[model samples]
Target: MDRSFYSRSSLIINTIESTISGDRVFTGNQPDDFALAGLLRNTKTACLLGVGYGGAVRAMLAGDPSIELTLVDNDAALIEFTGNLFARSFPGVAFTSETADAGSHLREHPGCYDVICVDLYSAVGYPRMVLDVGFWHDVREALTENGRVVVNAWGLPEQLSPLAPPSPQHAVAQAMLAVWQDLSHLPCRRNTTFVAPALTPADLRPPVDDASTRLSYEDHLTLGLIRLRGASAPVLLRGGIGDAGQPAPTSRRAIDAEMHARWPGLVEAVTGRAEASADFRAALSERKLTDAATERLLLEGSPAASFAPCIASAKAQLGELSMAWYGEWLCDEWFRLKALDPDWFRMSALWQAVCMARTPLGAVWPWEARLYDMLSAELLDAGFADAGV
Candidate 1:
C-alpha cells in the first residue's frame, strides 16, 4: 500500500511502511483523532494525557482560539520538545505542557480541567497506573463541574476477558468500569468505534461515520465517560465516593475547619503553625499564613538552591501581575522541590508555601489534603511513622 493508504482511519493495521515512516507521513487525520477533536470542540479548557505525536493536539487546535490546553506526559524531553513545537505552531492558542506523572499531577493540581483525555500507553500497553482505580479517583477530583473525562482505549469492553484472569484487555475494561461507576450518579455514555456490548447500532448515527469515510469507528476506539459533578463530594471521600454521607459546607471557614478536624495535627505538620503555638498566638490578630511576618519568616530561612526564586517572589501583598508572577514562582518551586530529596519536614514547609500561594483565601484545597495523604503514605512506607491502623 502507498504511504497515504497506510494512513488508515481505524489504525487497525500497522503496516511496515507506516511503521517505518510513522504518522508523520500520513496525509489525513485518523477518524479517532477527528472524533477526539469533536469531543473537545466546545471545551474551553482541556487536559490531555499521553500527548504522543500531537495528532490530538492538532485536532484540538483546529476548533477554536478559545481553547486553553494543558498537555502532560511523563516524559520530560517529549514535553519540552512538543511544548516548543506547539508554541511555535499554534502561536495564538493558550497552551502549556508539563513533564509529570499524570496521577501525581492530578493529585497535586485538583479540579483544574474542563475535559480530561486519557490516551496513555506504553510498549506493553497502557501503563499500570493508568489502569488504577486511584488514578481515576484523582481524575474525578481534578475535573470541573460539567467536565467530562473521555478515555481513549482500544477494543470492546464486554468482549475483553473478565477481571478474574486479569488480561490486558480486562484491565483496560476494569479501569473504564471504575470510571463509569464513579460517575454513575451522573449522566454517562460509552462510545466505541466498533459495535461493543455497551452500545447499540441504532446509537451509532450521522457524522460519527459519514458515508464518505465509511470507517468502523466502533472497532477503532472506546471512550469511557465520567461526568463531573457541580457540588463537591462529601467532606470526606474515603476513596472515590465510598462512605460519602455528610454534605460539605458551603462556607470557606467551615471547609477549613472540617479539614482540620478530619486530619488532626495536619495543620501543624503542614504549616508549622499550631493554634497553641507562640507563632499562632502572635498571629492571632493577623491573617496567619498570608501575613507579612510569615512570608518574612519563610524567606529568612536558608531554602534549597532551587527555591531562591520562590523566596524572592514572595511579597506582603501583590497586584494582579505580581500575583500571577508569584503563582509561576510557586509552580516552579513545586516541581523543583518534588524532584529534590525526601526531607519530609523541609518538603512539607515548601509544599505548604506553594499551597498557600496558590490559594489566596487560605482555605485548604482538596489537593492539599491529597498531598498530605501522599506524604503520609510515603512516611509509612519508609518506616518513619505508625501504620496508623
Candidate 2:
C-alpha cells in the first residue's frame, strides 16, 4: 500500500494521566518492553496495525521526526479521531482506517513497511486468523526485508486473575514464538529469542558463565530488570488468557458461579491443580521460579540457540525495573496511553524509580486493582483482548 493506503480517518481523544506522577501511557508495560525504543530509535518507516489509541505512533514521532508512521484500526471513530489529532503534529506521517482485518491489509500491501505492529485485543483468543495460516505470510510480504513486526498480545482473563499479577509478556512471546517457529520451517532462519520469566541465564546464554560470556539475563534479574532474550522475539505478551474466557465479574456471585462452571477446568489446565484459587502475589513469587526453571530446561529444544539479552540497556535503573514489576504496573504503558489520551494518561512511569526501591515485584498497585475489577466486570470487554492471548 502507498501513502494513501496508510492514511484514513476517525480517532478518539481520551487521555489517562498517571494516578501517581501525572504521567501518561498506553496501558501496562513501559514504552519499550525490551527497550524497543532503541530498535525504533532510528527507524524511518513505521506502521501500527491495531492502533488502540495510537501511543506508539506518537512515541515514534517524538523519538525521530524523520520517521513515517501509519496507524490502522477497524474502529472508524478511533481511526478518524486519532487521524485528526496526530495530523496536526505529524504532517508528513500517514494515518488510515480499514474495514478490513490487519491480516487482509498486510496481504494487500506487500513489502511496504519498515515496522508492522499488531496491537490486537479481544475475547476470541488472540485473533487466531493473524497467528497462523496466511497472516504471517502476508505480514512478511508487507515488511521490508529487514523490517520487524511487534505484536502486543493481550493476556487471557484467567491470566489476569485479580487473584494475582498477570504474566502478560509470556503469552506475548509465545504467540510470536509459534509464528517464528513455523516460519523457520523454511530452514534458513531461526527465531532469535524466547524471552521469558521462565528462562534462566543458563537456559539461553552460553554456559561458560564467565568473563566475555557472562549472562545478561541473570545480571538484569540480579539488578532487577530482565532484558529481552533470544532473537527479537516476534511477540511479547502482557498476560496469559486461555483459549476460553472467564465469567463476568459484575458481582462476586456471578464470578463464583462462572468460576464453578468453567474457571476450575481452565485453571487446572494452566496450573494443573483441581479448583484451587491463587493469589496474585503468591502467583508472582511461584511463577518467577517456575518460569525461570522452565526456560532453563527449554534449551534442549534448540541446541544451536544461545540466550539473547532481554533489555537493550539492562543496566538502566540498575535492575530496579525487575524489582518494581509486581509492585507497579509497567509505567511504560502509561506513556503509551498518554500518546493517545494525553489528559488521562499521565507520565507516572518514573514512579518506578521510587516504587522499585520499596518492593521487588511483590507489592501491587491500588489503581490497577480497580482496573482489573473493571476489566473483569465487562463480559463484553474480553473481546478487546482476544488477539495474542
Candidate 3:
C-alpha cells in the first residue's frame, strides 16, 4: 500500500474538508510535532514508546531520512498495523517494532536512543506504570548523554468540564505530579500545543523533494495536527538532576496559586472581579446568602458582566455542547465525557466559570487546576513566556 493512502482515513479527512469549507482555523498542531522532528535533525537513533497513529514516526522520517527508529507498543495488532505501514511507507528509513512493554524495552536496551518519545496511553487513561517514579528513573537511565525524553501528557480538557473543582483523582493531574516529582531534579522545559479546529490540507503539504512523503503522509500530518489540537503539550523533562533530585511541588493549591500569580489579570477576569472579592468575603461570613444565591452573585452579580467576553470567546471556539455541561456533571462522569469531546475553548470558558463560582467559603464545585497549566503552556508556546498579564 502506498503510505500516502493511509492519510485518507475518514476519521480526519472529513474534518479537514469541513474546516477548509469554513476557513475557521488557527496554527494547528504540526508546529509542535515539526519541532519534535527537528530534535532529530542530525540524530541516527530514536525510540517511540507508543505507536498511537504513528505521527511521530512519520515526523522523524520526514526530518531525517537516515534516522533509525525502534517503535514499541503493547498491542500486537497496533504493532502489526503501524509496523507494516512504516515498512512499506519508508523503505529507506531503518525501522524496528517490538511487541512488549515500553519500560521493559527501555530496561533491555539502556542508553540506546537519542530521542525517547513516551506516548504510552490506553483509551481509559495513561497506564499506571507511566505514573511510577521508578519508570521515569528507568527512562533516565535509557537516554544517551544530551538525549531527550518527551512524555505525552494529555492536558486538554476534552472530558472534564472546567466548572469542576481540581482533584488529585484525575489521571492527567496524577501523571503530571508524578512527572515533576520523579524528574524535578532534571533540567526541563515544557512545551504545549493548543487545540484548534483542523486546517485545510493544502496548508500542510509535504515537501516536494520528498515524493515519498507527498500525498501519502501529508493527509496524515494534517489529520494528526488537528487531532492533537485537543491534547496537552508533551514536556521535555530533560537534563541533569539537581539537589539529589529535589522533588517538584505537586500540591493542587500551590499550583493554582502559582498560576494565579503568573496571569493575575486573566485569573481575576475569569474567576472573580476586582471588587467581587470583597463581596465574596462578605458573603462567606454574613451567612445570609444561600450557596445558590452566592454563586449567582459571583457569576451574574455586580461586575460579573466583565467576564462575558471570555465566556463568549470560549463558547464560540468550543461549541455549545462542550460548554453546556460545565457545572452539571459529576467529577468522573465529566472526565469521561470531556475526553470524548475534547474542546479547548469550552474548557477555557468553563474554567472561568469555575473560578467565578468560587466563594471565600472554599472550593465547592469541580475544576481542574491543570487548566491553568494547560493555558500557561499554550501562552508560552505562542511566545508569551514573558507576557506581563
Candidate 4:
C-alpha cells in the first residue's frame, strides 16, 4: 500500500526499460501532453481543465510562455494551490482559476479554446461527464477554428477506448465498433477520430487545410500517432465512469499479456528483449535503464537520429522517480518519523516538495500526466509519448 515503496527510480526505469531492453517499449501509444502540445503553433493559447496537482498546468506554462492558460479544477484548495504556484512560474500568461466541471465550463465558452483536456487523474479516473453523449457534443462546440481535445486515460492501449476505433470504449471491441458507427453519423463538419494505438500508416490521411485540401506527409504521421490506444476506447468498470475495474490481479496479468501480443516487434525494439516481462520489474532493472549506449543503437538505424538524445533524456527520469518515490514513502513515514524525531520527519517532507526531472521515462511521480500533457501538446521528444503518439 506504500505508493513510494513501489514508485522509486526503478519505477521510472520500468517505463523506459521496456524500450531499453529491446522488447516492446513506447506501446506506440504516445503520452497525452506530447501529442497534444504539437497541435498548437508555438504561440497558441491553451486551457487545462482539471488542474489537480497542476503538473500539466506547470508544464504548459513553463514550456510555452506565449500560451494563455485557464486552469479549472473542482477542488478549491487544489485550484488555489496550483494556481498560485503556476502564477509565480508564469507571470505573463493568462491564468484563471475556476471551480467548476470541465464540461460545464466549455459549454459557457464555445469555440474559444485551441485545446481542451478531458483528463481523468485530477478526478482519479472519474470524469462522469465523458460518459454522457451530450457532453462530447458540447465539447465539439467548445473548439476554436483548429482546436483539438485530448481525453487522458489510464487504460491500456487496447482498453483506451471502449471497443477500439471504428469502435468506442463503452463495452467490448464490438461495442466500440457500434459506437464509432454511431459517432460517425453524428452531426459535425467532418469530425475525424481514431484510437491512438491502432492507427496504422494507412488509417490517417493527411489533414487538409480545407477538408478537400491534401494533407502533407508530415501531418499524416502526426495524426496517425494520436490514435487512442488499442482498437477501441478503454472499457469502464461495471460501476461508475473512470473507475478502472479491478478485474483481479490475475485478470490484469492476462490483460498485460494481451498488450504484449499486440505489437511484439515494437515493444521488443524499445526494450531489446525477446519477450517482455509480465512482472516488468525484471525487464526494467537499472542495467537496462542506465544503458547510455541504448539510444545509440536506435539512433544508428533511424532517420530520426535527432531523437537519440531522448534515450539519454529518459535517464533523467530516474532521478525524479527517485524523488517522487521518496516523497510517497515520506508521506507514509510521518508516524515513523514522529516516533524517531519530529525534526527529521519534517525535513523528509520538505525534501519531497521538490521533484526536478525533465524526462518522463525517469520521473518518479507517474509521468502519465506529463505524458498526456506533452502528448496532448504533441511534442515528439523521444520519450514514451513519442512512441505511443
Top-scoring candidate (TM-score): 3
Candidate lDDT scores, in order, read: 0.38, 0.35, 0.39, 0.36
- Candidate 2 has its poorest 10 consecutive residues by lDDT at 183-192
Q: In model 3, what is the error at residue 336, expressed in angstroms?
A: 38
TM-score of each: 0.38, 0.42, 0.43, 0.42
Best by lDDT: 3
Q: Which scores greater on TM-score, model 1 or model 2?
A: 2
| lDDT tens digits by residue: candidate 3, 1-389 | 23432332222211211111011111122222432432332455788787764545655554344567788988888788666654654343457889998888989988887667676654454466765767876776777765655555432222222111232122332333343432211001111221111122222222223423432222323223322332333222222111212322224444344334434433333334333444433322232222223234334432222233233223423333223234332232334434433332222323334322221112323343433334344334533332101
Off by over 4 Å in 3: 1-37, 40-42, 87-94, 156-389
lDDT of 1 at 237: 14
Question: Candidate 3's error at 152, in angstroms?
Answer: 0.8
Residue lDDT tens for model 2, 1-389: 11211223332233321111112212123222322321342355666776654555533333233456676777777677566655653345444555556876787888787667666644333455544535656766787865666544433222123222223333334344444432110000111212222222232221111211211221112111111112212223333323323322323343345335544443333332211364322333353432332233233332111111111012222332332343233232433433432211111222222223212222343444433333222212222121101
Model 4 / residue 103 / CA error / Å: 1.8
Instruction: Give one digit per residue, the lDDT tens place, for model 4 in 1-389.
Output: 11110112232223210111111112121232323332334326566666655545423432233456677776788788655643544333346778887777888998887666554332123344554556666765777765555554333332111223221233222222322222211000011122321222232222212211222222222232332221122222222233324321113344345434544543344345313332223333333331222233323442121111222232343432322333333334434433443322221121112112223344335533443333333324322232323
Model 1, 45-136: lDDT tens digits are 77878776554564443323345778888888767766664454433335788888888888887888766767665434445575577887
